[model samples]
Target: MEPLFRLALLRPAIAQDPDRPSVELAQQTDFQRALSAASGAPDPRTGLRRVVGEYVAGPL
Candidate 1:
Protein backbone atom coordinates (compact mmCIF):
# COMPACT_ATOMS: atom_id res chain seq x y z
CA MET A 1 0.00 0.00 0.00
CA GLU A 2 1.10 3.55 -0.74
CA PRO A 3 1.34 6.54 1.54
CA LEU A 4 -1.69 8.08 -0.11
CA PHE A 5 -3.50 4.78 0.08
CA ARG A 6 -2.74 4.51 3.79
CA LEU A 7 -3.73 8.12 4.17
CA ALA A 8 -6.88 7.42 2.31
CA LEU A 9 -7.65 4.66 4.72
CA LEU A 10 -7.12 7.09 7.57
CA ARG A 11 -8.61 10.11 5.79
CA PRO A 12 -10.73 9.49 2.75
CA ALA A 13 -10.60 13.14 1.78
CA ILE A 14 -7.19 12.47 0.29
CA ALA A 15 -8.93 10.50 -2.43
CA GLN A 16 -11.30 13.34 -3.11
CA ASP A 17 -8.84 15.99 -4.18
CA PRO A 18 -10.42 18.47 -6.55
CA ASP A 19 -7.96 17.81 -9.39
CA ARG A 20 -7.21 14.26 -8.21
CA PRO A 21 -3.53 14.46 -9.14
CA SER A 22 -2.39 12.64 -6.00
CA VAL A 23 -5.03 9.97 -6.36
CA GLU A 24 -4.21 9.45 -10.02
CA LEU A 25 -0.49 9.20 -9.31
CA ALA A 26 -1.08 6.71 -6.52
CA GLN A 27 -3.29 4.61 -8.77
CA GLN A 28 -0.72 4.73 -11.52
CA THR A 29 2.00 3.65 -9.10
CA ASP A 30 -0.25 0.80 -8.00
CA PHE A 31 -0.86 -0.18 -11.62
CA GLN A 32 2.86 -0.29 -12.30
CA ARG A 33 3.50 -2.51 -9.31
CA ALA A 34 0.58 -4.78 -10.18
CA LEU A 35 1.69 -5.10 -13.78
CA SER A 36 5.25 -5.84 -12.69
CA ALA A 37 4.09 -8.47 -10.26
CA ALA A 38 1.65 -10.09 -12.69
CA SER A 39 4.23 -10.45 -15.42
CA GLY A 40 6.98 -11.63 -13.07
CA ALA A 41 5.80 -14.73 -11.26
CA PRO A 42 3.28 -17.53 -10.81
CA ASP A 43 3.12 -16.53 -7.15
CA PRO A 44 1.94 -12.95 -6.94
CA ARG A 45 3.52 -12.47 -3.51
CA THR A 46 6.98 -13.26 -4.83
CA GLY A 47 6.68 -10.83 -7.68
CA LEU A 48 5.11 -8.13 -5.57
CA ARG A 49 7.85 -8.54 -2.99
CA ARG A 50 10.49 -8.06 -5.63
CA VAL A 51 8.84 -4.91 -6.88
CA VAL A 52 8.35 -3.57 -3.40
CA GLY A 53 11.93 -4.37 -2.49
CA GLU A 54 13.22 -2.53 -5.48
CA TYR A 55 10.93 0.38 -4.73
CA VAL A 56 12.15 0.63 -1.18
CA ALA A 57 15.79 0.22 -2.10
CA GLY A 58 15.82 2.16 -5.34
CA PRO A 59 16.79 5.80 -5.62
CA LEU A 60 13.94 8.13 -4.96
Candidate 2:
Protein backbone atom coordinates (compact mmCIF):
# COMPACT_ATOMS: atom_id res chain seq x y z
CA MET A 1 0.00 0.00 0.00
CA GLU A 2 0.89 3.69 -0.09
CA PRO A 3 2.01 3.54 3.53
CA LEU A 4 4.72 0.99 2.73
CA PHE A 5 6.26 3.14 -0.04
CA ARG A 6 6.30 6.09 2.33
CA LEU A 7 8.07 4.10 5.00
CA ALA A 8 10.40 2.47 2.46
CA LEU A 9 8.98 -0.88 3.56
CA LEU A 10 6.99 -3.55 1.82
CA ARG A 11 3.45 -4.49 2.84
CA PRO A 12 3.16 -7.25 5.43
CA ALA A 13 2.17 -10.62 4.02
CA ILE A 14 2.33 -14.40 4.43
CA ALA A 15 4.83 -16.39 2.40
CA GLN A 16 3.70 -19.34 0.30
CA ASP A 17 6.24 -21.62 1.95
CA PRO A 18 5.93 -21.59 5.72
CA ASP A 19 9.46 -22.86 6.26
CA ARG A 20 10.99 -20.41 3.79
CA PRO A 21 12.22 -17.01 4.87
CA SER A 22 10.39 -14.58 2.61
CA VAL A 23 8.01 -11.68 2.65
CA GLU A 24 5.25 -11.51 0.08
CA LEU A 25 4.65 -8.00 -1.16
CA ALA A 26 0.92 -7.73 -0.57
CA GLN A 27 -0.98 -6.56 -3.62
CA GLN A 28 -3.43 -3.67 -3.26
CA THR A 29 -6.53 -5.83 -3.33
CA ASP A 30 -5.09 -8.29 -0.86
CA PHE A 31 -4.23 -5.53 1.57
CA GLN A 32 -7.69 -4.04 1.41
CA ARG A 33 -9.34 -7.42 1.85
CA ALA A 34 -7.16 -8.25 4.84
CA LEU A 35 -7.98 -4.95 6.47
CA SER A 36 -11.68 -5.59 6.08
CA ALA A 37 -11.52 -9.17 7.32
CA ALA A 38 -9.54 -8.17 10.40
CA SER A 39 -11.67 -5.16 11.23
CA GLY A 40 -13.43 -7.19 13.95
CA ALA A 41 -11.27 -10.25 14.47
CA PRO A 42 -11.72 -11.53 17.97
CA ASP A 43 -10.08 -14.38 19.88
CA PRO A 44 -7.32 -14.57 17.30
CA ARG A 45 -5.06 -16.36 19.76
CA THR A 46 -7.30 -19.41 19.87
CA GLY A 47 -6.88 -20.15 16.17
CA LEU A 48 -3.20 -19.29 16.20
CA ARG A 49 -2.49 -21.56 19.14
CA ARG A 50 -4.05 -24.42 17.22
CA VAL A 51 -1.44 -24.24 14.51
CA VAL A 52 1.56 -22.98 16.52
CA GLY A 53 0.80 -24.67 19.85
CA GLU A 54 1.03 -23.20 23.36
CA TYR A 55 2.20 -19.57 23.30
CA VAL A 56 5.61 -18.63 24.57
CA ALA A 57 6.37 -14.99 25.17
CA GLY A 58 9.94 -13.79 25.05
CA PRO A 59 11.35 -11.60 27.79
CA LEU A 60 10.28 -8.00 27.62
Candidate 3:
Protein backbone atom coordinates (compact mmCIF):
# COMPACT_ATOMS: atom_id res chain seq x y z
CA MET A 1 0.00 0.00 0.00
CA GLU A 2 2.72 2.42 0.92
CA PRO A 3 4.70 1.63 -2.19
CA LEU A 4 1.64 2.02 -4.36
CA PHE A 5 0.92 5.42 -2.86
CA ARG A 6 4.48 6.44 -3.59
CA LEU A 7 4.07 5.31 -7.19
CA ALA A 8 0.84 7.26 -7.55
CA LEU A 9 2.67 10.36 -6.40
CA LEU A 10 5.56 9.72 -8.76
CA ARG A 11 3.46 9.10 -11.89
CA PRO A 12 2.29 12.67 -12.30
CA ALA A 13 5.87 13.93 -12.12
CA ILE A 14 6.80 11.58 -14.94
CA ALA A 15 3.79 12.62 -16.98
CA GLN A 16 4.69 16.27 -16.59
CA ASP A 17 8.18 15.82 -18.03
CA PRO A 18 8.37 17.32 -21.53
CA ASP A 19 11.92 16.33 -22.43
CA ARG A 20 11.71 12.52 -22.51
CA PRO A 21 8.88 10.91 -24.37
CA SER A 22 10.64 7.61 -24.92
CA VAL A 23 11.49 7.10 -21.28
CA GLU A 24 7.99 8.12 -20.21
CA LEU A 25 6.38 5.72 -22.63
CA ALA A 26 8.64 2.93 -21.44
CA GLN A 27 7.72 3.53 -17.84
CA GLN A 28 4.01 3.58 -18.62
CA THR A 29 4.34 0.37 -20.59
CA ASP A 30 6.21 -1.31 -17.75
CA PHE A 31 3.55 -0.24 -15.28
CA GLN A 32 0.78 -1.59 -17.48
CA ARG A 33 2.57 -4.90 -17.85
CA ALA A 34 3.07 -5.13 -14.10
CA LEU A 35 -0.63 -4.44 -13.57
CA SER A 36 -1.64 -7.11 -16.07
CA ALA A 37 0.64 -9.63 -14.42
CA ALA A 38 -0.74 -8.79 -11.02
CA SER A 39 -4.32 -9.21 -12.23
CA GLY A 40 -3.50 -12.76 -13.30
CA ALA A 41 -2.23 -13.89 -9.90
CA PRO A 42 -4.47 -16.14 -7.80
CA ASP A 43 -4.39 -13.93 -4.71
CA PRO A 44 -5.12 -10.25 -5.01
CA ARG A 45 -3.02 -9.16 -2.05
CA THR A 46 -0.04 -11.25 -3.07
CA GLY A 47 -0.34 -10.07 -6.65
CA LEU A 48 -0.47 -6.42 -5.67
CA ARG A 49 2.50 -6.85 -3.34
CA ARG A 50 4.55 -8.44 -6.08
CA VAL A 51 3.62 -5.70 -8.52
CA VAL A 52 4.55 -2.99 -6.06
CA GLY A 53 7.85 -4.69 -5.36
CA GLU A 54 8.65 -4.94 -9.03
CA TYR A 55 7.67 -1.34 -9.60
CA VAL A 56 9.92 -0.12 -6.80
CA ALA A 57 12.77 -2.17 -8.17
CA GLY A 58 12.33 -0.78 -11.67
CA PRO A 59 13.67 2.51 -13.02
CA LEU A 60 12.19 5.41 -11.11
Candidate 4:
Protein backbone atom coordinates (compact mmCIF):
# COMPACT_ATOMS: atom_id res chain seq x y z
CA MET A 1 0.00 0.00 0.00
CA GLU A 2 2.83 2.37 0.86
CA PRO A 3 4.55 1.65 -2.46
CA LEU A 4 1.32 2.15 -4.37
CA PHE A 5 0.69 5.47 -2.62
CA ARG A 6 4.26 6.54 -3.27
CA LEU A 7 3.94 5.59 -6.96
CA ALA A 8 0.70 7.55 -7.26
CA LEU A 9 2.45 10.57 -5.82
CA LEU A 10 5.26 10.19 -8.35
CA ARG A 11 2.90 10.47 -11.33
CA PRO A 12 -0.14 12.51 -12.15
CA ALA A 13 -3.15 10.26 -12.56
CA ILE A 14 -5.78 10.68 -15.27
CA ALA A 15 -9.39 10.56 -14.19
CA GLN A 16 -11.74 8.48 -16.27
CA ASP A 17 -15.16 9.86 -17.10
CA PRO A 18 -17.73 7.29 -18.13
CA ASP A 19 -20.19 10.01 -19.00
CA ARG A 20 -17.92 11.45 -21.66
CA PRO A 21 -17.75 9.07 -24.62
CA SER A 22 -14.59 10.11 -26.40
CA VAL A 23 -11.17 9.04 -25.21
CA GLU A 24 -7.99 10.04 -27.03
CA LEU A 25 -4.73 8.10 -27.03
CA ALA A 26 -2.94 11.23 -28.25
CA GLN A 27 -3.60 12.98 -24.96
CA GLN A 28 -1.08 11.13 -22.82
CA THR A 29 1.16 12.60 -20.12
CA ASP A 30 4.88 11.98 -19.58
CA PHE A 31 4.18 9.43 -16.86
CA GLN A 32 1.72 7.59 -19.11
CA ARG A 33 4.22 7.65 -21.96
CA ALA A 34 6.92 6.12 -19.74
CA LEU A 35 4.54 3.48 -18.39
CA SER A 36 3.61 2.49 -21.96
CA ALA A 37 7.25 1.57 -22.67
CA ALA A 38 7.15 -1.50 -20.39
CA SER A 39 6.95 -4.66 -22.53
CA GLY A 40 8.73 -7.43 -20.55
CA ALA A 41 7.04 -6.65 -17.24
CA PRO A 42 7.47 -9.63 -14.93
CA ASP A 43 10.37 -9.06 -12.55
CA PRO A 44 9.21 -9.13 -8.93
CA ARG A 45 12.88 -9.24 -7.90
CA THR A 46 13.49 -5.62 -8.83
CA GLY A 47 10.30 -4.39 -7.15
CA LEU A 48 11.14 -6.34 -4.02
CA ARG A 49 14.65 -4.93 -4.05
CA ARG A 50 13.30 -1.37 -4.25
CA VAL A 51 10.86 -1.94 -1.38
CA VAL A 52 13.56 -3.43 0.77
CA GLY A 53 15.93 -0.61 -0.10
CA GLU A 54 13.29 1.94 0.90
CA TYR A 55 12.79 0.18 4.20
CA VAL A 56 16.52 0.18 4.93
CA ALA A 57 17.41 3.58 3.51
CA GLY A 58 14.45 5.46 4.96
CA PRO A 59 12.76 8.46 3.17
CA LEU A 60 13.43 9.69 -0.36
Q: Give candidates' CA RMSD values in order.
A: 9.2, 13.6, 11.7, 13.3
Off by over 4 Å in 2: 1-28, 43-60
lDDT of each: 0.68, 0.51, 0.74, 0.60
What are the clashing pairs of model 3? none
Please give the range of 10 consecutive residues that has the lowest summed lDDT in model 4: 31-40
How many backbone clashes are present in model 1? Answer: 0
Q: Could you give candidate 2's per-residue lDDT for residues 1-60 as a string of tens digits?
A: 687586656556544876663775555764345454555468655545543332234223
Report the C-alpha lDDT of model 4 over 1-60, residue by residue, as the tens digit.
699999989999777887774666555754344344432347756655655565567654
lDDT tens per residue, model 3, 31-56:
77778778888886788888889788
Q: Candidate 1: lDDT of 21? A: 57
The C-alpha TM-scores of every prediction are 0.39, 0.23, 0.40, 0.28
Q: Against the true structure, whose lDDT is highest?
A: 3
Worst 10 residues of 2 by lDDT: 51-60
Report how far residue 5 has shifted in candidate 1, in Å: 20
Off by over 4 Å in 1: 1-40
